[model samples]
Target chain A: MSTSSDVDLDEVYSFALDLAKQAGKMLDDAWRARCDGGPQTGHVEKESAVDLVTQTDEDVEAFIKQEIASKFPIHKFIGEETYSKGSSKEYLIGKEPTWCIDPLDGTVNYIHIFPMFCVSIGFILDGEPAIGVIHAPFLNQTFSACRGKGAWLNGTQRLPLIRNPIPPMPQDAPKGCVFSCEWGKDRRDQPDGNLHRKVESFFNMAAEIGGRQGKGGMVHGVRSLGSATLDLAYCAMGAFDIWWEGGCWEWDVAAGICLLKEAGGLVTTANPPTDPSTARIEDTKLGGRLYLAIRPAGDTEQETGRQGQERTVREVWRRVRHLDYPRPGA
Target chain B: MSTSSDVDLDEVYSFALDLAKQAGKMLDDAWRARCDGGPQTGHVEKESAVDLVTQTDEDVEAFIKQEIASKFPIHKFIGEETYSKGSSKEYLIGKEPTWCIDPLDGTVNYIHIFPMFCVSIGFILDGEPAIGVIHAPFLNQTFSACRGKGAWLNGTQRLPLIRNPIPPMPQDAPKGCVFSCEWGKDRRDQPDGNLHRKVESFFNMAAEIGGRQGKGGMVHGVRSLGSATLDLAYCAMGAFDIWWEGGCWEWDVAAGICLLKEAGGLVTTANPPTDPSTARIEDTKLGGRLYLAIRPAGDTEQETGRQGQERTVREVWRRVRHLDYPRPGA
Candidate 1:
C-alpha cells in the first residue's frame, strides 16, 4: 500500500494529465465523426431509459486503462464503464494507490453535440484524493491539480480564475450564491425517491427568498448542466458557488473533489450533520455518494475562508431536503 | 416601415454580426478586468434580488445602440437595459425595421463569470425576424443568420452543424429528446405562480417513462443553462432538440428565433394551443412572452423536418404545464 508520503504525486499528476488529454482527443474525434457522418454513434441503454453508454465511452476507457497499466502496473483502476459491467470484485477503495476515471463524463451532452462533456482522471493514495485532471475538448479547457501543489487551468492560470480579492459570502447565503445541481437518472416519483427530493429541494432553493414557509434560501440562481464532473470543476474555478449532488458514483466526482480541495474549497456530506455545531467538513469521505461542495470564500472583517464556507453550508443544509443515497455495501 | 422583401437582409446581417462581435469583445474585456482586478465590477439589483444589472450591461447596450443608430439611421432600436429603464414610449413591436438587442443576454451569468452568456442582435422587418447574430466570447462561438438564408457558425459552417443525414424524431417523441429550459427570475411559490408551475413541469418531464401515470415524457435529459439566447442559439445548431421557456422578453429570444428559423427549426407558443387540431405553429406571435422552440428534425421514412418539429412540439406541450407570461402591452 502506497501512502501519500511515499507516492511521487508530481509523477502521478503528469501521467494523469497526459492520459486525460488523450481521452479528450478520443472523445472529440468520435463526436466530430458523429456530426460529420450519421446515426452510427452507437449508443445503448444502461441502467434505465435515460442512462446511456456509447462505444466511444468504452474505447476511451480502454485506452486510458491500458496506458495506466503500462506505465504504473501496480496501481489499481476503477473506471465507470468497467464498474458498470459488474467487474468490481474489489471496488472498495483500498490503501493502495488507485485511479478513478470517467472517460466521457457527459455522454448525453456529447450525443446531442452540446459541447459540455469531458474526460476525467483522478488518482488517490492512502484513501485520499491526490491528483486530478479533467479535460473538456470542445470547451477548450483543462483543469489539473496535485495535493499541496494547488490547482491550475490549462497548466497556466491558477484556480478560482478570479485573482482580485474574493468577495465574502453574504450574511444571507444561498441567497446571493449561484447554486449548481443536477436531476440524476433516477427519476422515480415515490415520496422518498431521488427525483421527488431533488425537485422539492430545487423549488425550495429557487423560491422567493422568504417564501416556502421559511424553507426558502432563494439562492441567486439554480443551474442544471447535466455533468457533475464539470459542475465540480466550475465550482473549483469559483464560477459556481456551491454544488449539491447524489446518485453519482466516485468516477463522476472524484477528480472534481480533488480539484476543489486543491483550489481551497470544502467538500462535505450532502446530508445535514446531526450536530451541526460539532461537525467537521474535513471528515467527508470519497465514496459517500452524496456530497456538498462549496468554493473558496473571500475574507471579510470577521469571517475566514473556512468560517464562510461553514456558514454557507449551514444555510444551504437548512434549505435542502434530506436525500437518501446509501453508501455502496453499507 | 420596411418589409422583408424590400429590406437588404444581407447587409443587415453583416452589420449585425460585426456589432455582435464588438459587443462580445466589450463583455470579454469587462469580464477579464473583473477577474484580474477586485470588486470594482459595479452591479445592482434589478426587479428582484436574483435579477441583476451591471455597468457592463449598460455600457454594452449603450454602445450597441449608438452603433446601430449610426449605421442604420432609419432603423428602430430596443435594448434590454434601455427597456428596463422607464423610456419605453415605443416599446411595442411595430411594422418597422427594428433591431432588438440584449447587449448582455445573461447578466447573472456574466456577473458570476459563467461562460454561457452572450451578445444577441436581432433585426426585424415588418414585424418579422430578418437578420440575427449571437456571439459568445468565452465559448468562442458566433452564430448568425439572414432571413431566407441559412444560419452559420463563425460565418463558415452551415447550421444543424450535423452534416450527415438527419435521423427522424423517435416515435416516442420526448422519450429520447434533449430538452432545454430555464428557471426564470420569477420565484413566486403560489400554486399558479411561475416557480410552482416550472418545478411541477420539470418533475413531470424527468420522471420515469411510465411512472408519472401517463404524464411522464421521460425525456432523455433536462438542462437549465440560464441563458435563453444561448439556448435558442444552441437549438439552431441542433445541439438542443427543444427549448421551452417563459418570463423572457422578446430581446432574449428574437435573435435566436431568427437563427432557428433560418436553420430549418420551428418556434411556437410555449402554451399548449387551445385548438390543437387547428393550431398552426407558424402563427406563433413574437410578442408572446412564452415560447416553445424545436430544432431541425432528422429526415425519416415517414416524416419531414416540419412534420417532426410539429409532432415533437405536441408531445412536449402535453408534458409541460401552462405558464402565464402576459404580452408586454396586453
Candidate 2:
C-alpha cells in the first residue's frame, strides 16, 4: 500500500547501496578465507552433495538483517538461506515494504573460489522492488538502481543500455555472440536428448543469426560466468546482449531485475509470455525462468530494435528445438 | 637456449607478473577513457571486427614489447596483434627463448566493458613455455607458473590443486561432459544446425549423466570464457576440468599451454594423435587447430608418491565421447 509519491526513492537507494557494500565485505572476508584453505575445506552445509554453503552465508545474512531492522524496523526482510529453512510463505511476501536479499549469490562458486559472486540487496515496497543494489567486492563494482531514475554502476552515472535492430544485424557485428547458461541441478529428469538439443541449438542459432537459418551469422561466441546476478549486471551494461537462464529463484534475480530495467534492458520469459498483458516481469512471474534482451543506448530504430532482438531469440529457440524437453518444474 | 640450470625461475616469474600488471594498468587507463567517451565508433577491420580492440590493446602490447626489449634483450617475443600480421614464416620456433603474449586476452569482452578479460604473458625457452603469468585485472586475480616449481596464484601461494577423488561420480561420468566450443570466423563453411548438434549433445549428456547414462552420472557443465588463454587458465586453476577449443590459432593457446601443464593438468588433441609415441608435447613445432584438455590433480588410491592425475584424466576421457566432425583444414 505504497505509491511512488509516498516513497523517497533517493533515500532508499542510498540505504540499499550501503547495505550491499556491508554485506559484500562480509562475503569477501569469507571468500578470501575459503580460497586460502583451497577449494574444498570451506563447506559448512549441503546445498547438494557437491554444492556447499559456508558460515559466511549465514554471517552475512544475519548482519544484513540486523542492519535492516535497525534502519527500518517496520520493513519485512527475506534471505535465501533462511527461506530455505521455513517461515516464509504467502504471509510474508504478501506483506508490504519487504526487503529481499541474497547476501552472497553464487555461494557454490564463491566456495570454489570463482569470482563472479555478489551481495544483492533489494527493497520491495508495495510488493515491488523499488530500490536494488548489487555489490561485487572482489571486483569492487557496485550496480545500484532507484525506481524511475535509472541505474548506475559504481554510483551517480546512469547506464543507458541500447541495441540496434536485430533482423538485419550490423555488418560489423561478430557472428559469434556469447551467452551465459546453467546446467541446472535436476539433470536426471530431462529427456534423453532434450537437454543436449537445447544447448546445441543455442550455438546453432548464434551461428545463424543474420546468416541463413543453418549457416553461420553474426554471433562470435558465448560464455558462462556461473553467476546469475553478475550475468544480469553485465547484460545491463550491454556487455552481453542476451541472457537466458532457468531453474533460478526470485532472489537470484530481483536486484538484477531492477538494475537491468533501470539500464533500459528488457526481460521476458525464455518462453514468450502466454499473455503479455498479464506478464509479471518484476519477479519473472510469467515463467519459472527468464530471458533478458539488452540493447546498447542510442536513438534506436524501434521496428528494427524489436525484430533484431526477437529474431536473435527466435534463432536461439529454433536451435533449442532440437532438444525436446518439458519446461523445467512442469 | 634456456636449460633448467640456466633459467632464473624467480626472475622470469616476477618479470612476467610485472609485465602483466603494467599491461593491465594500460588497459585500465584505456577502459576509463572508453567509458568517458561513448561506445567505440567505427567499422570492423580486416584485423578485427567490432570496435573490439581498444586503445588498451595497442598500448598494452606496445608496453609489453618495449619492456621485453629492455629487460630480456636477447629473447624473441610474439604477440597477438603483431603475430596476426605477417611475420617471416621462417621465424619458426626453435630452441631459443621466446615470449608469447596476449596482452588483453578477451578483447571483445573488454570492449564491451565486460570484466572477464585478462592480460596473458608467457615465456618460452627451448621451444616450450618455461614461465607464464595471466593477470585478470578486473577480477583482481593473477595465475602464474614456473616450469618445475609448479603454478601459483598471486605468487607465494602454491596451488595445492589436489581434489580428493570425486567419490566415483555416482553416475558413470558421461563421455558427453561439458565442451567449451567456439563459433569463430567460420560460419558458412559449416551449417549452424550441424554445429548446433554438438551443443545439443553436450547438454543432453550433461543432463542425463546421473540418470540416463550408466551410473546416472550427469555431464558436469560447459563454459566459454571467450578468451582461449583464460579458458586454459581456468582449467589450470582447476576451476574447469576440461576446456575443448577449436577454430583458434597457436597464439591463443601458447602461454596457456605452459600454465595448464604446470598445474598438474593434461592437454591432448580432441582427435587422437596419428602416432601417439611421436606426440611430443614439448615440441612447439606441431601447430594444429584442434582439441585441448586440462585435467586437475587427483590423488591415487594407491599410496604412490606421484600424483595419480593421469588415472583421473583417463577416466574422464573414457566418459566423454566427442561429436564426430569433418576435419576443418582437410
Candidate 3:
C-alpha cells in the first residue's frame, strides 16, 4: 500500500532517521545504565498503577522492532510496547507499509527523570502518515519529515531556520500565547466530566479578561510538558501556541502528526462534530485521541518568509476549543 | 547584617555566580533581539494581559540591578521589576543586606518561547538566604547555593555530584514521585477555590484506586514548569519530587529557598497552621508567596552519605499537602 509514487521518499526518510537514531542510542545506553543520577531504577508497571512501562520501555520497543525487522523485513508493525496487549485495540487497517512506533514516548516522563521524553517514528503509506521521525535525546531535538520534504529541525539546511520558520498565530493572538495541554490516564472527576472539562479548560485558559469571573482564555501560558510527542514537536516548533489533547495513542500521535503537518501546523479535534452538517475534517476519527495543535495560522498577515499564520480555521476554533469534553464511553 | 561568620561564603557564591552568569548573558542577548523566530515579540504588558512583561522583562531587570549595584556597593535591593510597582510590597526586613532578584523568571515563559525561564539570585543576611543563584539560560541549567555551602549543578564538582546524587524520598516510595506545579497569575475557578483545589489536587493526584471514585495522587508525573527558578531548581536537581507555589515573589523564593535548603530539601507551607503548637519550620512565613518543595525525606532508614530523607515531618506533611487552598484575601 505504499504510495507517494512507489516509496522512495529519500529512502523512507533515511530509514526513519536511522531508526530514530537507533531508538535514541538504545535510549542513551539504557539511560546510562539505570540512570547514573537521572532516571533511577528500571521502573516497571502498565495498564494501571498510574500506567507506566519501563526497562527502558521494553528495551526501546525491542530495539525498534529489531531495527525494523532487519531493514524492512516485509514491513508492517505498531509498537507502543508490543501493540499494547489485552482487550484488543491495535488499529490502522489496510495500509501495509507501516511502522508506527512510540519506542519511549513519555514512559511516565521516563520513570520520573522527566526531561520531556521522546523517540517517536512514523511511516505508513497509502493509509496516510508518510514518513516522520522525532528524537529528543534529552532535548537535543530532531524532528524530521518526508512526503514532499518540509518539516526539519536539528538539520534545517534552509538557512537561518527559514527567516522565521514556524511562528504565526498572531491576530491579536490570545494575548501572549503558548498554550499546551495533557493530564491523561483519564482520572475522570466531577459528576465525571473528564476532570470537569479539564478543570474547566485549565481555568478557562488561564483566567483574566476582567480577571476571574471573566470566563477567561487569557492564555499567555499553561503548559503540561509531559510529552504527546513533545506535544506535537513543540507544536511543530512554533514552541507551543496551543496543544489540546485526550487519551492518546496512534503510537502517541504518529510521529507528531508528521511534525504537525510539515510545520504548516493546524491539526484539530479536541471535540468536534457539533452538527456541522455531516461534519468532516476528513471524517474525524483519529485515535491518537482527541488533539488540537494550532501553531500555524492564516488570514493573510504573515509575510516575511511565510510558511503559516493568518489565524483562520475559524479563528483558531474560536480561540482554543474544548467542545464539551468528557466523552469516552459516554 | 552579614553574619555567617562575616560572610565570605565563597565570596558570596562567586559573586552570585558572576551575577547569575551576567543575567544569563543579558537574557541571551535580549532573547536574540525580539525573538527573531522564537518568542515572537516584546509582548508589552505588565500586570495583566495574561500578567506579562517584556522588553526582555525590563531588560533582564535592568541587567540584574546593574550587576548587583556594581558588585555590592553597600548592598540592599529587591528587584522583581522594582518591587512590582504600585500596590506596595517590598518584603524582607530587618538585618538588611538583601539582593533578591528575579529578573526574568519565566516572563510568561519568556514571551512564550516556552523554555522554562530563569536568572534568579539571592543573598539576604540576617534575613537569611545567605546566597544563591539560578541560571537556566534556555535550560543549560546553573543552580547555586552558599550560606553553609552545599548545593551546586552545572558545576557539580565536590565529587561526582556529591558521590551519586538525585536520590531522596524512599519510604516505600512507589507512589510515582515527580510533582511540580504552577498555573500562576491566578485564574481561580470552581467558585475560586484555588481553581477548585487545583482541579481537586490535580484530580486527587492523578486518580486511580478503583478509578476516579477512589480518588488519586497515584502520581508518577505532573510537571508545570513555567519556571519558579526552574521549579526550585528542578526540585533541587533530584529532578522534581515535589514543588508547590503560591502567587510567587521573594525574588521568586529567594533563589529557590537557597536551592531548597542546599538540596537536602523540604520548604513547607501551602497553608500551615493547624498547630500541635509552636510551628517552627524556621518560623514558616515564606514570602516567596507560599512554597512546598520536599525532596529529601526522613524517618531514619536513609543511611550512607545521607543528605536528607528519613521522611517524618508528620510523614512529609501528610503526603503532599495543599490544605484546601483559596487563601489570598479569601
Best by DockQ: 1
TM agreement with the true structure for every prediction: 0.96, 0.80, 0.34
Please state what fraction of the native interface contacts candidate 3 reproduces.
0.54
Candidate 1 wrongly placed segments (more than 4 Å): A1-6, A87-91, A275-278, B1-6, B87-91, B275-278
- Angstrom error of the Cα, residue B94, model 2: value is 1.7
User: Any residue pairs clashing in model 1, and if so which?
Assistant: none
| Residues B1-330 of candidate 3: C-alpha lDDT, one tens digit per residue | 443355566777787898788778878766565435555455666655667776677777787777778876677778787677747664544476778788888877665555678888888887778778888776576878776677777676321131254554644332556677877765544463565556555555555444444544556667787877787876666667777666776787887787777766767665544551345554235463667766643333445223333232333344333534332332
Candidate 3 CAPRI grade: incorrect
lDDT of each: 0.85, 0.61, 0.65
- Per-residue error (Å), model 3, residue A31: 16
Best by TM-score: 1
DockQ pick, better of 1 and 3: 1
Against the hidden true structure, what lDDT does model 3 obtain?
0.65
A213 in model 3: Cα distance from truth in Å?
Answer: 55
| Candidate 3 C-alpha error for residue B225, in Å | 8.9
Q: What does candidate 2's lDDT look like per residue over A206-325, in tens digits?
A: 554444445333465576766788888887777776677665666777788888877766666665444433444432442244454544433335435444555555444434433232
Q: What is the interface RMSD of candidate 1, in Å?
A: 1.2
Among the numbered candidates, top lDDT falls to: 1
lDDT of 2: 0.61
Model 2 C-alpha lDDT per residue in residues B32-98, reported as the tens digit of each score: 5556664442224444332255556766788899998998787787887776565433335567778
